[model samples]
Target: MDNVSSVIEFTLSGFDEILDYKLTFFCLTLLCYCVIIMVNVVVVVTIAMDRNLYEPMYIFICNLCINGLFGTAGFYPKFLLDLLSHHWGISYTGCLLQGLVIYTSVCSDICFLAVMAYDRLMAICRPLEHSSVMTRQRVAQLVCFSWLAPLGLLSASTIFTSRLKLCGSNIKKLYCANWMVAKLSCAATNWVTSTTPGNVIAYVIILFYIFLGVFIFCSYVQLTRCCFKSLANRGKFMKTCVPHLLALFNISIASLFDAMYMRYGSSDFPQSFQNLLALEIIIGPPLFNPLIYGLTLSQIRNQVLHKYLQNK
Candidate 1:
């Protein structure tokens, strides 16, 4: 039967597959996403209209809002629908598109964070060159590459992964992960394994290792320099750098753990743990980006309040 038969579509076990916690999980996730979206939207609005927030940092914040918005959009709709219906069904093309957008948003998120880190590094460590180094043209170029590089990577991923012949059961995690899709392949092991490098999981690790190494070294050096300054100047420097450090902490922990989990633990770990890890992909950055940036920037807080009053 194994050799003779073939497969078509995949099925997913909805979060409510066990029962009882359906409504609770639904309400909690919905509330969490609502907060994430609202806060990011406020940041975006403040950056757009507030004259005071027209700086490199806030511009990066705006870009982060857009990425988080689209990224959540890609996952939350299906997640919500699954909660409502207690069934998880996505079309083949739908799965592909979801994977594509989710990966793109993720890659874009990485690029933006790296850009933000470099921006902070220049401002803190190379203050004289801050303006000249991160000029409008340079910032525009960086942002463009952030958006474009993901497309290139994802295109390579989608093409190689799609060519493999999926056999029968398509039921993956609540979402369509590329590796899980590859698991359904009837093709030879080599063909399936060949697809790993093109997958999102692999590239995420490669990019993060490089980025994280550089980020940690740069941040530590900057923090060390700040420690030696006078209390007043040091406090000012710390104020600017603290949020970035916090953001780096959040990104580093969530990304490193999840990447490691997906790579090494997918098979060994329990299904529940794997699912939780996948949720981190959606929830971690959304929760941190606005909170960290808002806490750090006075201008952002003022603009947010100003906008709230004007809308009222």
Candidate 2:
């Protein structure tokens, strides 16, 4: 195939062809990106600088914020330019790097969230041991591993992707994504087909062990028991857990569905649904993840508020 074919570059049929929302989309996306960066920066910096946020959970939050910031950093500039110029022209290396950043960040994001869940489980289930178990050393190790795993995956995948020869004009969807980039290849679709399964299986296994089998089940059981024991002060526990639970649920659903869509329904899906799904998967979680940590989290909120008040 390589001998027979010349390398092909993709021609993205711009979103303006069907929807003339380029300028509008550019403004909206820029605003959203700005908010995402600002909020996440404040949250991460506050956690790092604040004396009260020196604990394991806050450290996890810091990692989460950092992942999000980097993840958005990878996509927003290119996306913003595409939106403004309505030019979806991207080189092979640039597209590959975008995919690398996205996959790396996404893989790290999910892994870190799972780690955070485990941390929370320890805190709730074994409060006495939580301090020792979720130490700074351990949290740092987890963050390192989270980052390294994705980089490894991306490296392996990129090797295979780089070998594929492209033919004809590259056809792309509204966004720049790995699978979309891969589809433009004249070579076999095996990479695209295989990528989702490997990632989903890895995450699902982690989910099974950490979330389904242990954290979710055990934590809820203990949390329930605690709530029942504190009948008069039920609201206290609820207030603490509500935001984290919601955040996890949101991330899980969005991530899981994204994986599923990529694996099973890529070609069969409607363009509009595909567009919306991609947007939701990309932008929605980043927009909300910080809110889940910053606004709902008492320590983060308190620090932010205190800083704001002092500045005022």
Task: Judging by TM-score against the true structure, name the best candidate.
Answer: 1
Off by over 4 Å in 2: 1-8, 17-19, 187-240, 260-270
User: Model 1, residue 93: what's the lDDT?
Assistant: 66
Candidate 2 lDDT by residue in tens digits, 5-43: 254345555353445667777788889999999988898
For candidate 1, list the clashing residue pairs, or say none.
7-167, 7-168, 10-170, 10-171, 11-171
Q: After superposition, how far is residue 50 of candidate 1 from its true place, in Å?
A: 0.7
Q: Candidate 2 local accuracy as lDDT?
A: 0.68
Assess every candidate by TM-score. Answer: 0.85, 0.82
Q: What is the C-alpha lDDT of each candidate?
A: 0.72, 0.68
Positional deviation of residue 129's Cα in model 1 after best superposition, in angstroms = 1.6
Candidate 1 weakest lDDT stretch, 10 residues: 1-10
Q: How close is candidate 1 to the true structure, as a TM-score?
A: 0.85
The alpha-carbon RMSD values of the candidates against the true structure, listed in the order shown, are: 3.8, 4.0
Poorest 10 consecutive residues by lDDT, candidate 2? 1-10
